[model samples]
Target: MFSLRARDAMSASWAVSLLSKSLTGFSFWIVGTGAASAHVKWFCAYDAAGQPRGLENVLCRDFELLLGVALLWFFSGCVVERTSLGELLVRSINRVTEGLRLHTEVMIRAVCGFFFISLWAVGGIILTPELKTTSPQVGLLQLAIAAGLLSRRTMPFSAAGIVVLFGLAVRDYGTFHLADYPIFLGLAAYLALTGLQKDLFGVPPLDVVRYATAVTLMWASVEKWAYPEWSFPLLIEHPGITLGFDNEFYMRAAGMVEFTLAFALAWTPLVRRVAAAMLLGMFISACFEFGWLDVIGHSGIIVVLVAILADDRPREAEYRAPWLAPAGLCAALTVTLFTYYVGHAAMFNTSIL
Candidate 1:
């Protein structure tokens, strides 16, 4: 009996050692190969030792930390999912979703649509080097704009974000730029103005936004994995990989994080707020990096306005800002066109301009 027990113990120890090696090897492979890893390098781990300490470094550090937190959150999710309680909660949530009404579904879909749009922005960052060349002025200016929109009760941030996106598309025509200022600001502003901010706050169905975002992110992630060339590997080697986390591995991991968070929030409200904060943090970082501080300011203003108006439970009449809303939206559109012209004038000149 004693001899048999000793042999079993020895076998178990060997098995554990082998498992450890396998895990380490797997991690290395995940980070060392592809566009996600390259994205990770640009946004999370890029070296900036000799660079001047200004808005640029601050922006880089924030993104690096953001990526690191996302990675940690991903690992923590694995632990959570492995628990019995997590399994139970997940099944219960699925049941709830199955029973939701059409209105609830529409609201969910809208939120999700925005989230996927954000993913496209992130993907653009990884795949297009030109976006990586964004100037600090641009980032800060956007941030300011986002903040302002977020604080405005009558503004639609989603519309604003779309407008901003149009601006960016114009600014860098033919280049894939993943700027989120336009979308986030636009969506948030819309919610604030439409009285929906109060309608959904503290409700169980509020998770529709996150769930929708997650679904899009999950598919996007699969596509990234399926097409490794267009993934992080190509991105990392691109001349524009500026941030540490701008590598293929990291970008993939970020996508994974977004996907996981979206699902996790669907299961638990606790994580929903965290996910929102992460999204906001990313936007803030972008504002500084491109000197698009206006985006940050405008987006933030809209959010605040929504929060205040929501708490006050103001009448629909008070919430409606007919003139300003359209004006802000038109202004956003004009800026987008101007920026696009600046970014693509060269190409246009080469072709037909």
Candidate 2:
């Protein structure tokens, strides 16, 4: 009897150890495919005005399953946010990021400066890789934007220049294509509001950037669901990113993860910081696969995420009700889905079904 009991215990222990290792390995694999988050249009053929897959196709069984899981995960995070554990985590993060917190603004400015200069260096690109331009003036405009970031007084001008560039991109590419990058407008808003020492309707500049980042990511995630085929070429080119899963299922899962993390950015302080940190890691890891374009294109968001991670300020009106966070998440998901499907259909003269 004693021998049998010991054997049973040893088997259980080994099983637990194997499970742990498997999960760890799986996580590393997921992180390594961080380039999966890159703008697919940059690497594949995409028509902004083309009709995306129908809502019925996108919201299939796999998507529903993922949505349920994401809801549970988000609700659990909200519950945790109310506990002492959340407070402790926030305190620890604040303590470790003390230096970063102090220089967040300067760091953001410097990074944006570098990003604009890189864009100028690579000219013929309107904001991102796919938005090509033949005009020499765009490069000069980017150079001016970079130069504006040199002084607090001139940062607003830089912000204006960013807006102008975005407008030009929209003019050339259309609203659907430009929708992939609201983060630029967020950066522009951040620079303008901070430089002018003003706030929009009482919201702080950094918060504006945070909200914009969340929206940008959420919107991008919707694209993955609506047009998973757009990324098929990328997967075909780099098969290793699938991690043994069917390519279609992998894209859906990727969209779920991105949407969930992006939604968490608007949650409690601890949750947002952790989400930002994870996203920052993903972006950095993606650079290894994508090289300079990923680095420069992601530089602005990386800086924003860093600032978010380092932010230690107390939020006066965070979601205190246990149910509010989950409700907000659901509402956000619904809105983005409706807008993407309905809005796209309307804009492109296609049916949502």
Question: Which numbered prediction scores highest in TM-score against the true structure?
Answer: 2
- Candidate 1: what lDDT? 0.37
C-alpha root-mean-square deviation, candidate 2:
6.6
Error of 2 at 238 (Å): 2.4
Candidate 1: where is the Cα deviation over 4 Å? 1-153, 157-197, 200-216, 231-258, 271-353
Return model 1's CA RMSD, one decimal.
17.2
Model 2 per-residue lDDT tens digits across residues 216-324: 9999999998888999988887788777666887788778778888988877787889888888877887787778888888898899999999998887587567677
For residue 204, what is the lDDT in candidate 2? 89
| Model 2 lDDT at residue 334 | 90
Writing each residue's lDDT as its tens digit, candidate 1 over 13-111 gives 978855653443334223322223222222333221122122232234333334344445544544454368655754564444343322432342333
**Runs in model 2 lying further than 4 Å from the true structure:** 1-33
Q: Residue 70 deviation, candidate 2, in Å?
A: 0.9
For every candidate in turn, the CA RMSD to the true structure comes to 17.2, 6.6
**Superposed Cα deviation of residue 101, candidate 1 (Å):** 29
